[model samples]
Target: MKIQKFGAGVFTIENFLSKKECDAYIHDSESRGYEVATINAISGPEINKEIRNNDRVIFDDTELANALFQRAKGFLPASLHGW
Candidate 1:
């Protein structure tokens, strides 16, 4: 994993997921279906098209999440300076 840091806490990891991995994720999400995306406001989570107009799938797949996190862990800092 190659990480590139830009100014102002911006960063990017090239090829974090290969084409095959990305395709699998897309397929899985599509199979589950997507709902209108929502945004978190002071009022709480709600669909706000102006803010974010897209579809998303919210699911609980801890195994997948942990796998991805582990793959990227080596490129991540233990903690941020101010956060």
Candidate 2:
């Protein structure tokens, strides 16, 4: 697999997640009650109730977070490691 690197210091691995993985992620996120997306504003953030377009899910699972990080860490720049 070829990792595409952009001039703006952005790297992407095409087809990183398979179809089954995507389906499983969507199912898990929906089951966890994270389908609702929030609206961001200068004052504060508010829950969007009208049209549900974005399904934002927070990474509270440490194991999952660590695993994903490990998988993508090699593609990331070293300067972004600490912060």
Residue pairs with backbone overlap in model 1 = none
lDDT of 1 by residue, 1-83 (tens): 68889977789999999999989999999999999999998999999888899998999989989999999898887888956
**lDDT score, candidate 2:** 0.76
Please provide TM-scores, in order, for all candidate models, with all chains considered together: 0.81, 0.63
- Off-target runs (Cα >4 Å) in candidate 2 are 5-7, 39-42, 47-53, 80-83
Q: What is the C-alpha local distance difference test score of each model?
A: 0.91, 0.76
Write model 2 residue lDDT over 1-83, tens digit each, in one string: 45888766677787777889889998987777764677886778777577446767775789988887898787777786466
Error at 30, model 1, angstroms: 0.9
Worst 10 residues of 1 by lDDT: 74-83
Question: What does the lDDT read for residue 20 in candidate 1?
Answer: 100
